[model samples]
Target chain A: MPAAVDVGELVERARRGQPRAIARLLSLVEDGHPQLREIAAALTPHTGHARVIGLTGPPGVGKSTSTSMLVSALRRAGRRVGVLAVDPSSPFSGGALLGDRIRMTEHAVDAGVFIRSMATRGHLGGLSVATPQALRVLDGAGFDDVLIETVGVGQSEIDIVRLADTTVLLLAPGMGDGVQAAKAGVLEVADVFVVNKADRDGADATVRELRQAVAFGHREAGGPPWRQPIVRTVASRGEGAGDVLRALDEHAEWLADSGESRRRRAARAVGEIEAIALHRLRGELAGVGGGRLTELAERVVDRAVDPFTAADELLTNLHTT
Target chain B: MPAAVDVGELVERARRGQPRAIARLLSLVEDGHPQLREIAAALTPHTGHARVIGLTGPPGVGKSTSTSMLVSALRRAGRRVGVLAVDPSSPFSGGALLGDRIRMTEHAVDAGVFIRSMATRGHLGGLSVATPQALRVLDGAGFDDVLIETVGVGQSEIDIVRLADTTVLLLAPGMGDGVQAAKAGVLEVADVFVVNKADRDGADATVRELRQAVAFGHREAGGPPWRQPIVRTVASRGEGAGDVLRALDEHAEWLADSGESRRRRAARAVGEIEAIALHRLRGELAGVGGGRLTELAERVVDRAVDPFTAADELLTNLHTT
Candidate 1:
């Protein structure tokens, strides 16, 4: 079993603006140890305090650089911020190289900013299994704004929307046909789409294609009725970062005024609860004693009875006996 | 509520070469109505009788044409076959076009061949929520062989390996770099790799690259030693379909000899059972007595206690009262 961390103590330290404590807590959660439940329980009150904005797109879309710029922009507005950068797991080894933090070293010593790198840790999604819990920790720790940067590999990119109140999708020009961006699963989930590397020649056409795609109705109920705004950003120079942050602020305001924020929060709560319940049940099922369950499984497989009826019978027997 | 069909009777009719019954059963399963469980429960015993082969790759790689050719080839071998073609769900409409079936209409009336087109039905991975259950129905109906043709949408393609006893990953010549294949999450899961459209330029290089990728891995004990062979095929012309089938047979034989077949089947059963359990639990939790659970969720969200303890306490209260 992984060593247990004192989640309360970690949260208190993070609340007091201790970067090391915050980083360590984020790492523990990202590793997805079973003990994450204890930490999440301790951190729940701290969520809903920070505005979480998620940055996601295809790999090599300059997500990390864009995130750094966004963080810088938030800091310039005198708001203390937190950054969580998520990387993909290597299929061969199930390990992740958290290389995004290298670009954010400028904030390492800044008292106003905190940056942490995270891995998916066997989770199929781009977001870490414990990401929502970790976000709760950061939120409880009194960060005014939190930025999550995700390595968008495929369907997993969809998970980021659940974790963030606002989602920005980054697209680079000259990468592929502009249509590929529309074909990729990210188009439907993004609230604000950015064409990064606008200095490239095809940027205008990519922006046009993205506008058309967004014009095709994709937003869920309670979001802005208009299409998602397509902005051009040269993130390396920190250009257009402020506009992105302002857009996020406007989205947050809209969510608050339109009562969509509560609906999203409720949906997220239900999703999180369901996920936790499933995880716990898996653990319990794995721990059931002996070859008994296996025998039952074999009997079911042999068609003595169906799995549903057999499962109910097993549970009933366990309860009654 | 959708009307529930008599799936067992449907299966019996389908086995006697009734096309409409087979289509109806497939439609019932695809919609994920409550009746799917009943149909699957009745059909479970009849599965494990068919040799299941999965074909997957990126879109525009001729997967549908390849599937058509494979169905033709299997018929020539005098084997009764069933093809389940999976299509992508439209992000905008949450429905599937199911276009692949149009290509395979020539076999519609062939008694020895049964063809069905399935949509992803909002499943993130290439496989449908009811895919395994549907496969069981076809298998139980006494089809000598079953072919699952996946949507070839990158990561979801990996889900096919779990359901299939033998998996073939197809590639087209001059397709993006071999690294893109690895990044697409296909290289690691394929049992046999095929370079379709072999008449196209760069077929040899694609094959060589795939061979190199396969050679880089040294096999471990439990999993099949990844000796994925790269077969060059003009699938539209049926030039190498026979060779593909022979390779599939050899792999099947290897799996049986090494006891991996039993292990794979066991893993699949456990996976299916887990999915079913979670699905049922979600339904139960949703209907668990109104505002009481909502109150508990709010308290849990407020950090009053850990979710595990909260869940336990709730269950304990329910039992005692």
Candidate 2:
């Protein structure tokens, strides 16, 4: 069993803007150790203070650069920001490489900005297992804004929309088409659509295609009330970053006015708690019966009997024993 | 509530090659209706008859073409084949378009060939809730071989390899150097690597790069007993299909001789059953409490409290009630 973690101390240290404590707390939660639950329960009240935004797209779409530019722009607007750049988990070690953090050295020394690279840590959904808890910590730590950058637009990636007030889908010029976007499942969730690397060829065509795609799918002629703005940005040069920020601000306002923001936040809270519960149940179940599950599984595989029946018997045993 | 299904009758109809019954059985398992447990129990005794293979790669890597060609080749070899092409779920209805089956229409008339397309169905791991159960049904129906063709390579795609007796990774020409192969999580899982679209530029380079990448990763000079053969093919033209089949045959022999085949199948069976159990439990939980779980989830988003604690409380209530 893992050692018990001190929830209060970790929260206090994180609130004081200690990066290491924040990282450690996130690690504890991502690992799904029993103690992380206590820490998350304590941190819940601290969330809802920071405006969280999500950035997602296919790999090699310049998501990291876009995030850096967005952070710089938010700082220019006089807001303290926290960034969580999530990398895909390693299949072998089930850990993340955290490679994207190497690209964001510009904000490391700025006290107004806190940047951290989180790995999925084998969470089924693309978000970090402890993301909601970590967001709460950042909220209590007094960050005015939080930006979550995901590696790809998998189902897990869509989970970001639930956690963020606004989600920006980043696309690169000369990449895929509207069908590809639909396939990635990004068009449905994005509040803002950005064609990054706008200086590249086909930028206008890609933007037009995205607009048409959105128009075709929108229920109303004027488009959904959120108005997913398609902005062109050369993130590498920080060009058009202001427009992205403006779009985000406008969307934030829309969210507040429509009262959907509060509802989404509540839904996100429930999802986070459910995720934690599932994680814990999986762990606890794996530990029961002195690992008899493995033996029974093998027996089922050996054709001694069927797995469904085996599982039923196990559940029955759990009930009676 | 969905209507209860008859497992034995459905299985018997599917065994007689009734497409509607097969489709209905698949839907029942996919939706996690309570009857799936009974259906799976009935089908378990009939599995272990099909030689399951997994095909996976990045988008536009010619996975569909390769799968089509492979099915054709297997048919020519006098084998009854079943193909399950896994596509992303439709966002609107959460159903698959079943496009792959349409693409392979030539095989539709052939009684020996059965093709089905499965959607991820909201599972984060990319496998549908009913995949394993569906595979079992197909197997029980007397398919000499079953091929699981995944549309994209994500974490969930890796799960396909664990389910198959032999796993093939398809790579398109000009998809970057062998480093791209390594980075895409294909290098570790593939038993056979195919440099598809041989007519395209960089086909030779891709093959050479893959050879070098495999060499660098292999600790032993002989290549880990199961050497990943790099086969070049223009799957559209059905070129090099013979060599691919021969390579598969050799790999199957190798696996059997080394006892890896039995071990892999056993592991796959356990995993399939566990996944089915988890799927069933999720559905059961979703159906309880008059959907209060979903409502509480909304409350969590509203910031009433943290999700971790809420989930635990919900699970506790579920267990007690």
Candidate 3:
């Protein structure tokens, strides 16, 4: 538990766009400090205003470079922006070059832009719990737009799709990333696709392949009918960033008209609440005498009872205890 | 709920190696039929004898081919084998192209072999619930070896490593798979690394890179000193299959000698029990009037209370109800 702090003052300062206060609040969330509940309470009113966007793709698809370009484009439109670069790998390794931070230094002096890199300290569900709270903090701080950047590799990274209102999957030419994305089930989560480094030799081919893949990757029969557009960009030279912005705007509008944004946010809330609830339940179960549970497990192993029955008995004992 | 099943008779037949009875038991588990509890109760005494192995790797890495060859080798060694090839993709998609089934035909008619393919139908944690129960059925049926095969592309697939006593991670040359494996954090989960397609060009390089990666991927300080072995196998020709088997035997010996096997199985039991318990809790939460949870969420959204506090209220209300 953390010492009692003036959460109200922190919230006020953050609401007034004080970067240090906002950073402190986010740190509290990331560290799972006891003040987090107070911070969440404070920030609740100012959330749901920012349009959260997720950017992900296979490694080396210039995800960071494209994210930087997206930031510039959003800032040009006079919208305050925040970026979260998520490293899906374990934090213990600690060699995260975070090369993207170098690319993002252009916005280092801008008060309207915030960038942070997040890593999981190998705790299960660590990223899932922290990322959303950080987003809320940024949203409460009045960032009109928040961009989440992550490497699209494993299951944990796939979680970013749930947090973002719109997910952009980036790929480059000649990487056979389209197939890899499908295998990873990432293709199904994409709201929009981008072929970065379009000036490269295989840009057109990549775009064509993505278009074809997206065709077969259609949602359910009665989905919004918003065709996932594939745009090509050369993020290095800042070309076609505006097109991505336009696509985002179009998706945002579709989300609004289709009433999907509310549903997505509601679903996200339900998932988070359930996860927290489950975590608490696990804690309660752990506090139960290990000998009792092991005895029941041994009974199940010895053919005296089924696992479901053992589980039922355990739960019953848990509640009574 | 299903009709009252003659669980005692079914168990007796399955114990006598009746394939139909075994199939019926597995089906009950997968479908969550009411008879499942009875079946589990009947089979509990016959469990914990079979050696469970997990085979996983990226796409195009000859995972299926290698699994097939491994099954053949085990059969020749007079071991009855069971395979569960899990497809993590949604069942609604209907494009699994599990073409590997064709390659497995060589053993299709072998009375000593059993193979089954499973899909999730997009239910979260569906595979987790079903896989273990099916393993129990096979184990109770007197199978000497059970091989669980899955495409290692997502987070859910990673759970397979926890379920198996020994996990074999397959890779091939020239795919930059070593680096990808490291990036995906698969290097850490591997107990045995197999370079499939050992005859391919760059096979030696892949093997060397894997050795280096495993050397560096040492487990936490003062943990088990088990060094992961890297083996090369050309599964198409059944080459090096014996070596892979030898490695598995070595790992099995190590697991038994160090008391790691019991600890692993106990941990696995605890995890499964917790997951099932959580699922029940989620169901209870869902059964709560949706409007109540939504109102609480709205209050959180409006900054009236933190989510934790709201969750606490919900749990209290649930207990009272």
Who wins the DockQ comparison?
2
Chain B alone vs. reference chain B, TM-score for every model? 0.81, 0.85, 0.89
lDDT assessment of candidate 1:
0.66
lDDT (C-alpha, whole model) for all candidates: 0.66, 0.69, 0.75
Considering summed lDDT, which 10 consecutive residues are worst modelled in model 1 chain A?
A: A89-98
Candidate 3: CAPRI quality band: acceptable
Say which prediction, candidate 1 or candidate 2, comes out ahead on DockQ.
2
A238-286 in candidate 2: lDDT tens per residue?
9999999889989988888777777667667656666666555555455
How do all models score by TM-score?
0.79, 0.86, 0.85
**Model 2 spans > 4 angstroms off:** A1-7, A87-102, A121-128, A177-184, A218-224, B1-9, B89-103, B106-108, B122-128, B176-186, B216-224, B287-304
lDDT of 2 by residue, B168-243 (tens): 8888777531124224455676788888898998888878877887886643133237778989899989998999
Residue-level lDDT of model 3, residues A1-321, one tens digit each, is 568779999989988888899888888888877777778877887788999998877655677778888989988999999887774421212323345246668888999998876754443346667787888899989999998877665565677667889999988876652245343456788899989999999888878877877878757345567789998999999999989999999999999888787777876776566656666676677677366678766665555666777778778877786
Could you give the C-alpha RMSD of every candidate to the true structure, in order shown?
A: 5.0, 4.2, 4.0
Task: For each candidate, report its DockQ versus the true two-chain complex.
Answer: 0.24, 0.36, 0.33
DockQ for model 3 equals 0.33
> What shift in Å separates residue A284 of candidate 2 from its native position after superposition?
2.9
- In candidate 1 chain B, what residue range of length 10 has the lowest lDDT sum? B89-98
